[model samples]
Target: MPDGDRYPLAHRLYPYARSADQDRDAGGPAHHPVIVVGGGPVGLALALDLGLRGTPTLVLDDAEGIGEGSRALCFSKRTLEIADRLGCGAPMVEKGVKWQVGKVFHDTDLLYEFDLLPEAGHKAPAFVNLPQPDAERFLVERIRTAISDGAPIEIRGRNRVTALETSQPARLQVETPDGPYALTADYVVACDGARSPVRKMLDLDFEGRVFEDNFLIADVRMKAEFPTERWFWFAPHFKSGDSALLHKQPDDVWRIDFQLGWDIDRKAELSEDRVRARVDAMLGEGVDYDLVWTSIYTFQCRRMRKFRHGPVLFAGDAAHQVSPFGARGANSGIQDADNLGWKLDLVVRGAAPDSLLDTYAEEREAAADENILASTRSTDFITPKSKASRMFRDATLALAARHPFARAMVNSGRLSMPSIYDSYLSMPDALPDGPPATRPGAPCPDAPLGDGFLLEKLGSKFTLLAIGCAAPETGLAVVACEPTPELTARYLGAAPSALYLIRPDQHVAARWPMADAATVAAAHSHACGATT
Candidate 1:
């Protein structure tokens, strides 16, 4: 067993000094332009995004620091790109275990191994495995740096919201260490997680299905030569009738999940002996491993019907939640922040109307639905509902070993990927013969540019990516990228020249082979919810 003292899991506390005292003396609630609740990955990310865009944000968290254990280990490429834009991607990638290969198994047999990224010329990989705590810490550091540089972002820890008033300008009654105080904001974002207090206070119902089976998640530190790849077993030898997942994290920590049946005694299952017995069975009896943390959770694939409730908005776990079969939880939440940040910034700056925020709900709700569907399918496949379902699942796995066609049907958690927004915000492609890879509503494909990737050249503002031709003069940021063979193949199929109007979030809003300034401006206006 590893020494617990040597590898201590310490919570870094952010000291809370009373800032509401002055407001109390002034006999009114302190006002902020934007107030974000729950300082988790999504909330922090949203604050960072708004801060970077020169929007003053105040973040309130009940907890002092990041959560314990290696939760949400798999960070997807799309999420990494979002983090990169937020100025914290490099550290996460550097600290994470980068891998793309995942192996699915039936009993002792290796059914199939799949590579998520077969061909890669992009800046970020298919996925990286960094513990949630580390990612949160990196974000916190980024926020602190921004705070130092006058970004107008303040994080007050141990400041919990006890009551919420969702008026035009939301009012929140916060309970701090000092005392209870009233606070108000022009806008309130609830990122308080699955058991969101904000959601509860508003009496919002999270409507969805909850799976019967429970999963035992245990983080174990051990010295082993296991390759940094995702290993999944369906009815494995160690756990004879259940599924098991083994994933590697930094610092030699491994996250193991055992799908315990519906009727398991939750407390007994999480006991040290029971947990150790399971780990020993999987890793062999003599393996030296230290139990870091263990928890039992039931899967619930659910979300609120509407992410936006009046002046208050919901992001991350507060808005939607899914079974952790796929890494959709944090990945989707980061995208939520990415989607909301720019839109909210526009509304804050009076560049767009408040109705622009509705577009955020529209686009993100579509994305959430996509994620929910994928996660639900994976959960159902993993934990079959009926005998027939189990039989079919087993047959599929059996055929997957030999039949190439069957491999495509296998669903061992279709890993998280960026969802293409197919809503009204995405303008239809004007060019009939444009490349589908750079189609409107799709994410902007990254390619090699001068010393950096093409995505690096695009600014946070609306950009016109002129490929293989001179960019037309426009008020928006424009970048003329020389079309190399790879670039041409990805962004400019048969066409020699194209103009892509990319959104602030790096999603292509419109594309045209040739367009005058009027057309480009109209597309931009349409993207910002203006009917031109």
Candidate 2:
């Protein structure tokens, strides 16, 4: 609490809000468990999950409504599991296009196509494209309904946080429709975008390199369409030095990005006629289309050194940003909210020490670094503007034109696989010797539960799956997730054996051998922070 938070107006409006003198004047009902700024998918999802768990939260966004435009449409299965937990997955999934194979093409010549279903056993596959605005609206409506239902959360639109001071307890001075008012909360999480005002205001260094070349993106609604099963990558087209990517979006629309070498004036080069000419060169002669929206942007792959400064923590783009290759932008941000929600839940409930909150930086920073590296690799390989690098990329795609598997490898490299946290402060060195089961540190494989439902049926909480045995009493009272032997056998093609433990975040926590009471208890204790 600060002097501003104790003002008469502040006291009158937020009487229940905590203040420096309020603790002395009798600490009121915990002033909003956490204050989250930025109501994008990351911030809103975080608030929704926290609210569902009965924690009070305040979310502020400057915008009048949910975000619009065609940005970040790829949703990973892990993200789906998170949305399922928050109870908002089905609607968003229904609005997107699910693909099995994403093909790469070099100037109308097929190079490689990847089947995500085979690589990760994800029946739905990797990376789907949809209008971001539609997804955001669905989430916003769900959040509003929860507020109407009396969830302990408040969302203030047209409100911007101007100054944030992170002293003993985090405090933010925000500008609302009414006036400037101060808010105090136990913790603050910033989910603001790349040019984060909070990051700049705090003077934290966003250390990374920005690429010099700029790219032009155009969204077009076309009557004639390409194959829905593929994503096109054009290299050295027309004059042996042009690069571009065309991805299909929902509603018969397409998003095309052209790497128009670094030096040309964007105004002169990116005109509608110039863009239409480029599309014609790749599609060959006559291609009818109407441009919906277009913009030009440079790529920057930078990350903040620290995601947390005292009580303030950064999630999503506020924490880091990467080149938009692999659709890492929003997908990674959603993962950030998922990772932080559980840790914040634990800390607020006093189930885990405040030190557990530090793991947020360690885990998400590693994920962010992976995004930067993958994006940089894709940019260098695909849009190599340098003479020498261009020659190399040309030679590489030419070779892939002959070999199919070689092309799949390159495309898979760009899909941006989920980074595992084997080295985190949490998790053990190795899975304890187990009878035969998926162990901790492994992504949980989807199996079948009884009554036609599947293993995917139990993801909202930490799950204890007993293969051929009943739930062992570990004293933690974890949900007993029974496995259907017939379904497990059909999927894994092996007889079901041993036990499987799923974390609250839907990751495999540990596997035990033959339902040994002691080992099961130990694994459960560790997963729940009892032993640690």
Candidate 3:
């Protein structure tokens, strides 16, 4: 985090090279099975997933490298898990600052504190604060390794999508330093972000609310004694009467967010002198620090009504938008990629019906709704538009400081949690099962195994996990193991034994107390969207 050059990964990682993809436009569009339109985290994760599934993929990115700064620093556990499955989690975890505790304050007084990860046995931590640019770089590096190992993935830098034809085998007009080229794909995933050119070309728009408030971000590199915890303040005594947040990132960088109500002088607020004055007040007189990055942001809670349009699909910010308060933006976008990847792969391979892709749109649409609702509430509570609302919020904060019950009502930010889908693919739960945590629709919880973790065992395949039971010949690969205490507690608290049908994305599709070939076959068929 040098002040001179900022983040090391900020320099171009991908070099632009001229390709003959342009000549394909003369005859017709060069056809691919799947194409991703952005090189950001979501796009890269999705491409990596598809390639790992043996689906040939090509990523057309406008830029040669990731964006600068610690743009989005909070990567959720779910995001890390997804990255692990994509073979890039180790580097991401190594380069991140992990924290699970958070504190909320009203002025100088502590209201209440919360722990994000209360228990052990999970593989990924609650959150890892790594710069987004570093994350992208790591994912790209992993993709390079996978390509070397023969994973049918190609990323072309400086290839920008200028136009799109959303018909079946969606066509794209791409511009590069060399010239313009055209290509087509059976499906085009738009991870081009909130200002998505793909969405605009397809004439799509987001629907929801935009917050009027602005928050200034000052990412400063310093040697601070502050603990690795998220500290948020409301009506701080420090000069400004607005809310603020302090979070530590990797490489001794700190992210400070100062809420600057509705009206703000963008120029003055961003000035070196003004930013330094604010930092001085927060850190007290003379803390030597170098400003690495600074920017102002106003957030919105919005999503497209439909994520799928004919042959084109949307993920990440292209599909939905939310305020940064809850850490939902990039986290949910990566989850979107997670959900869409396997389904698209199965569809492309002709192993599942094209309608299976509909579940991606539906389930992730539901998740976007969940995130939007939470983010909207956090924004409203943080910046009350009405006098009455502000007074009520203040009173609630005051009460939360003393009473424990009121703590639930105080919303600084809800934080990101994986969506337990009411998915059409989800099977109904049987009574008498203990692990609602591993319910049919929920993301599988990682538990310790003999040598590795349960998630690592699940890998990126449809797996049958039979615990304390004999493996049945269900035509699906099975991992039959004795029930460990953790597995027994999570899978069969009251029951004797359990068998779980896991999806390629590691989400539980179905579970039963005992294994039978007929039953397992039926469940597997249903989960895979097999035609009867």
Candidate 4:
């Protein structure tokens, strides 16, 4: 009963689905060249990528094994692309449920339904909802294989990195059941989570506002079946205080979250019976379910003011924690790895300088701040204080459901739109002063190519697009990819005036009617870490 549309898919689904650690490494001096503090998805993904790049990494986790808990199930297309690059996407694609349409309902009343796969693209919409543990397992297996293939990766379970100190490089003092041992690395990445000891030990400032409201989350197997077609979101479930969310997981499991207002007895309120009763109240009579897991937690939208400190860097929840409204936590964390992976590869290969690491803070910070604003706005909409805000929230969704453009806006907020980066290092060629064109620092959109491959295939590397005009013989070596026909028609009001340069991450690096020495130099300088 692993959710809907079950298929006998690939076996490698959720790479980190390692069996619980039954064997305890009798407290030994297990040291690697580079040690990853957290063994969560981010840390694991980092280890996998590092291994692929011929770097030996040590992953240490306090947990006995991978997590089975259903937290952060949604994976964006960008995330899938990263997984595919790691050779782990096939298994994930086979096992996970592809959600094409996301329906929003207000107390059994259908408000709006957005088809995530808007047009010709991957069959799996813009995202897939796979159990977090499954994903972790898939990755863990991959790491093990890489290790067998001479990857210097050692996964030490039940080992916690208690303290961190930097000398010439950086050092981690991990506490095991036996004793504390010292390990050093060229760099240390703190993906340990929100309550990261690394961030705390370093005394790095996590700055942001904390909302007073607490949310009660429960993963349960429902006795009463509901349509898997929609995501039920209620502002105030049957009252002005109680709120609930209904989402589907991989198995025949539903994850329900209730915003149980500002006041409640923390100790007594989270009891089993209390949770069961609350679920019954929301769905109304005859609703029965077996609670698989239950937890109460409060969150604040905050990010480490600085992602990098000396040789230490932060990823995932350790770097930022956004309200779960947009499913930003795990997705953004994975992207952080994506951002860092290639850059680190380049730096290690001497293709890029250490300064390239600075872009991690710059690009990711922008994304984090955007997530904060979006999550805060969503929370404000649902947990409205003033009458006007409540009314606006109601009217906005109501109106948008009827209007196409407005409908897009509503979906954008809910679907967690791909983040854009506006770094000080962005080039002028990418963002020409002329009317709005697909520019750098913007999430690259797909356009049609002749061979049925989307423009993105060419975008895996830095590209220069020529839409209408003849291709210019600029001395810079870049992928001169084609533009989307729709874009050419809409933006140019006709065939596009050729030459648009794109980045390796698929962002538009430079757009010109024709490529020239000035634009080529500008694009190269920007992409090669010269602008920074």
Candidate lDDT (C-alpha), each: 0.88, 0.68, 0.89, 0.68
Q: Cα lDDT of model 4 overall?
A: 0.68
Least accurate 10 contiguous residues by lDDT in model 3: 1-10
- In every candidate, how many clashes are there? 0, 0, 0, 31
Better of 2 and 3 by TM-score: 3
Per-residue lDDT of candidate 3, residues 23-120 (tens digit):
65466778899999999999999999999889999999999988887888899999999999888898888889999999998988998889999978
Estimate the TM-score of every prediction. Answer: 0.97, 0.85, 0.98, 0.81
> What is the clash count of model 4?
31
Instruction: Using lDDT, give the best candidate's number.
Output: 3
2 against 4, candidate with superior lDDT = 4
How does residue 42 of candidate 4 score in lDDT? 96
True lDDT of residue 7, candidate 4: 21
Instruction: For model 1, state the Cα shift of residue 455 in Å.
Output: 1.4
Worst 10 residues of 2 by lDDT: 5-14
- Candidate 3's C-alpha runs over 4 A off are 1-3
Q: Which RMSD values do the candidates have, in order?
A: 1.6, 7.3, 1.4, 5.5
- Sort all candidates by TM-score, best to worst: 3, 1, 2, 4
lDDT ranking, high to low: 3, 1, 4, 2
TM-score of 4: 0.81
lDDT of 2 by residue, 109-179 (tens): 87766676664423333556666666666667777778788877777766788998887577777776566
